[model samples]
Target: MSIQRELIETLQLNLIKHKVILLFGARQTGKTTLLKKLLTSDDDVLWLNGDESDVRLMLQNQTSAGLRAFIGAKKTVIIDEAQRIEDIGLTIKLIHDNYPEIKIIATGSSAFELKNKTNEPLTGRKLEFKLFQFSTKELVNHHGLLNENRLLQHRMIFGYYPDIVNNLGDETELLKNLADSYLFKDILMLDGIKKPEKLIKLLQALAFQVGSQVSYNEIGTLVGLDSKTIEKYVDLLEQSFVIFKLNSFSRNLRNELKFSRKIYFYDNGIRNAVINNFSPLAIRQDTGMLWENYLVSERMKRNHYDKNYCNSFFWRTKAQQEVDYLEEKNGKLFAYEFKWNSKKNAKITKTFTSNYPEAEINIITPENYLDFVL
Candidate 1:
């Protein structure tokens, strides 16, 4: 199944020779695959892999004339794993500034490394985009809504990573491999991680606490690391795209919980694999956790692809009244509650409604989830 990515059309329309296009995504999320689909012809494209020692050597410390000689008549240049190249920002800036007729596209799996390298040199000179796992809308477009709704159970367990989606029936093995090492490769390679085992333990601890506010101090004590170190590792994990942090939403309320945050894995399969549990919904105790994670992850993808900009968070008060997910856009509050069972009655608490009278309240159940996510 060679389904097209939703970003292809936007990327195609945004391509320009003067400013570079930077694509960032986790490894195996199909950055290269999307490039293959977008670049259809190789006639005038100069493809270089930064992972190659020779390629890195050739691009090291080059001047405008040097680059011109190297690139010779190529109209398009793509450097994959670009964060591996030292001073890639300067190199890209040179190409963008010197060659007005050459189009430049670079890809990296680590946002921290890539953004650190390019933020200054490429400021105001590049347009950036992030590609994530297959979204529900994309899947439905490829097949149909009925087929996708039928596969929801499997999706929550197996996730939507390109390879996992393409290779059905092998999700456990694939997710296990991903969770074991590939997801942490970049984080582990960076400095400041003295004990790697503690990092894994911390990730597992976070995995178990999905859909709830996380305390760095508690996780630190449980994992045998200090809170500062735990926070650093969590930030690194988020930048690597394995997980994300959602802060508590608070405004115009005296009892609102402030400065609290929850962490969630970007893909449910990775979260389950981290804890080594693949039980079905009937026998599982974490079905609600999985449902919340799936809904939030899909909504994030939809927001990014659709260019719907909003500030997202989970809302809770010191008194424990809570909303599962919240979004603030155009100065209006939108609160959501996620329930896997259609029979369960879920709604925003009156405390929340009274405090924010103009807010839009919604409950997302399995029967009506398509209206929310799609």
Candidate 2:
């Protein structure tokens, strides 16, 4: 079954405007699938894979005429894994500069490479989009609202990756392979890390500490690396879309704990795979952590897809009062706490409420989370 992605309309609009569209995501998140869906018989499309030496060599030609000859009147050119092609940014700049009528679509799994290559050359000439693993809203679109409750547990455990959601095969093995193979492939291939095991250990430690403040020195000690190296690995992991960091939110409160950050995985299944834990929720001791991670990630997808511009943080103080999620938009503050049980309710701490009296606070339980996220 083909699940239509929301980015198609945006990509089509960009194509009509003759802008280069760059689609980025983690490996196997359906970037190529999205591009294929946008292609049709009526369009004159030239498809090139950066992994191919011939394609790389053809695009490496520095002259505008050389690029024009390679394109040869093709109305559109699509490059897959474009970051692998040497001098791709310059090549793309030449093509775009000379052929104003040509449309270009490029897809890459690694942002560190692509962004560095294209940022300067394609400045103001490109539209960038991120395609995440399936979102709760997308699932609702596919199966309707009736099945959301039934699938919530599965989404929390197995995650919303396209292939995993579509397949009925062993999800554990699939997630294990994803964690073992594709999760760090870009990091290992692009960054010259001598000990991959250290990275794995760092990820495992992070998996166990989700929703909690992380200290670089502490993680470094646990993973047998220096703090600087630990920070670099974490940054690479975030760039690869495996995880994200949320910084502490402080507004000049002396008790506020600043300079600390919390880490969350982009998908729950990857987090579980790193920790080797996939037991049922009833038997799981970290269910609250799972729920917090799941909601935060889903909300992130929602914010991105809806183009909601906001700054996200987690609020904490020296007295140990905290809020699970904090979002500031248009100079207004919105805070939320996630509770796994529908009956349980979380209240805004008096200190937080008093300090930011203008901020709005809400508890997001299972019964009301759909409206909050979708």
Candidate 3:
């Protein structure tokens, strides 16, 4: 069964909306596949792969006339893995300026590579979109809610990476390959990452610490690196889309834990692969952390697809009062706590509730998690 991706129409609508479309995602999130689905035999397109040295050589240091001659009469040009080609932003800018009739699409696995290269050159000339791993809504649409609900534990363990979703019975090996291969390809290509083992060590430490407040100093000590290097490594990992940070929300309370962050992997499979743990949830001790990570990450996909404009955080106080997730939109605060066990009694902390009295709060469990994510 081919699962219909949600970003296809959005990308289709925006293709001609701007002179250039920049599609960014982590490796194997299906950017290339999604764009292929958007093309038809009726459209004229020229595809280029930046991974090829010849393609990189041909596109570099091109003038307007050179770009024009190279592109000829192509209506649409797609450069897959575009970040490999140096000066690609200038090349696209030249094409956009000279051939206003042509539409250019560029797909890059790493955002830092593409965004840093294009930000200045393609400022107003481009529309940007991020493609993520298979989302919960897409999965629900594919197999129906009843079946999807049954797969919740499986989803939490294996995650929703497109390839993982499509290729069953081979998920563990595939995730390990993805983690070992594409997960850090872009980061390791840089000059600063001389000791690749340290990067691996850092990720292993992070995998074990998922859903907890991350301390650079402690992580640095555990990984045998300084805090500054750890910060830089963490920044690179975030840019690579392997992980994300949710900052602590603070406002009126003096006890709020400010300047602290909790990091979650973009996909639970990647986190599990990092730690080399694919143990089922039944025998696992980290189910709560897994549930929290899955919920928060899926919520991110939901908001992105829904075009939700809201700020999200994990709120906590110095005295241990906390909320698992918090979102603010249109001057209204919504708070939630995640409980894996539906029978447990849960409530908002008096400290958090007293300060943000206007904030809405609820507890989410296996019985009602679908409402929170889907």
For model 2, which pairs clash?
A: none
lDDT of 1 by residue, 1-374 (tens): 98879999999988943578999988888888898888878888899998899999888899999999999988899999898899999998998898878999999878888899999999999999999989999999999999999999999988899889989888899888876667556567755767888988988999899999999999999999989999988988888888999999988588999899988888998888888998888899999999999999999999999999999999999889999999999998999999898787777899999988999999999989998888
- What's the lDDT for all of these models? 0.89, 0.88, 0.89
Greater lDDT among 1 and 2 belongs to 1
Off by over 4 Å in 1: none
Give the candidates in order of lDDT, highest first: 1, 3, 2
Give the TM-scores of the predictions, in the order they appear.
0.97, 0.96, 0.97
Q: Evaluate model 2: give its TM-score.
A: 0.96
Ranking by TM-score: 3, 1, 2
Better-scoring candidate (lDDT), 2 or 3: 3
